[model samples]
Target: MIKCCNYDRKYPMAWDREDFSRAYRRLAPVYDHGLLLYELVGMRLRRYRREAVAGLHLQPGDTVVDLGCGTGVNLPLLLGAVGPTGRIIGVDLSPEMLEQAQRKIDAEDWCNVELVASDMVDYVFPPHVDAVLATLALATIPDYDSVIRTIASALPPGGRLANFEMTWPEAWPDWLVKLGAKLQQPFGVTTDLKDRKPARSIQRHFARCDSSERYFGAISFCIAIRQAGTGVNV
Candidate 1:
């Protein structure tokens, strides 16, 4: 279940936050199952998630914020990275989504996790947050630019942010890209996804941002470190 393809776009009208909220409300229960649709296309979801978590470079007892943490899909991986002593803060806008995540926590009997219902943009990063992660979540934001910058400003020294997301593929044939866009429409994704890339924003704030692309440019993974002194107050 991709909790994090958090959203934003240049054209604010592309997707209303309320609309996504409703979509997730209906999708909450079936979210994990629905993720199989990607696997059918060879998405290798678990592998990607593991790779993203590894990029965080977490240490035992380190804290991580899972932005747009849909249904807590990343919880186990994060908890594994930081161990029992470490803490995980999972945030999402959909209450129902959080409910589903809570169920998972209860079933697993994990005690170091916290779930918060809030939009990523207005989410207040608590003190000592070692890292922030947004998986499949950032592109959905209406102003990902500000969201990324604000998170950068809020992190302590050496803190990092890792964002993983999909985009309209540049390497695909024109006809294929169109077909892909149509398929994503039911999820409220528009042709605007082609312009939803946030790599530039990550590079702007971090002196060094590492990036990788997969699925022929349709998928991206980026990790940026907030240099000792960069960013303005959020």
Candidate 2:
């Protein structure tokens, strides 16, 4: 049965690495094409990012890691928030996407940003980050629990994890949801998580979790933090 607020049919299945790799390689060239649809979605994500990061109360020189950074869209905002003294590390799996991000960094001459092309789920940072964010990338990863566990293990108590994902719309007519799902199939986009139990999976690693659905049924933002007794040490 589908959950009330969030329904996801994607969980019971997993996609292989080759499949994910191919998609990333293919998306490298036309990534911007799909992003046009996200103009409204982007605004919503930005708001959530700003709110979540600001709530972290970062100092002038705090550090943050952008998991699945994908062309570094959030790099500029993160740079401004963290200030010149702080650092922003962007991690992604696509080299082509990272190349575009690199060009942007060079063109803008942003000294506080660092881009790393690697699978965020497996990449290890020497020093733990103060905050971690993954915008819409979590939904694509097959290993949701492991990814959350990795992020939780890499942050200190009170460190924040802000995630933006595509969620199923609740209260919408069932026909609309079904129609949307059918429309996305041709493009290989799945709407299963719009109804999946992301919160339940999150709760396994985080002591506190809260979510907000925004953009009139297009996106979901989840903010989770490790609690004091969770034994999450930096």
Per-residue error for 106 in candidate 2, Å, reads 0.8
Q: Give candidate 1's whole-model lDDT.
A: 0.82
Give stretches of model 1 more than 4 Å off: 1-13, 171-175, 229-234
Prediction RMSDs, each to the true structure = 4.4, 5.4
Report, for every candidate in turn, its global Cα lDDT versus the true structure: 0.82, 0.70
Model 1 poorest ten-residue lDDT run: 2-11
lDDT, candidate 2, at 193: 52
lDDT of 1 by residue, 1-234 (tens): 323233342322456688788788888898898788988888877788998899889999999999999899999999999999999999999999899999999999999999999988898889889999899888877698888887887787788888888887666665565567567654656556677778777887676689888777888889888777654333
User: In candidate 2, what are the lDDT values of residues 58-163, reduced to their tens digit?
Assistant: 6678898888888777787788788999999998887877887888899999998988888867889748588887877776665766788888888888888888
Please count the clashing residue pairs in each candidate, in the order shown: 15, 10
lDDT of 1 at 18: 80
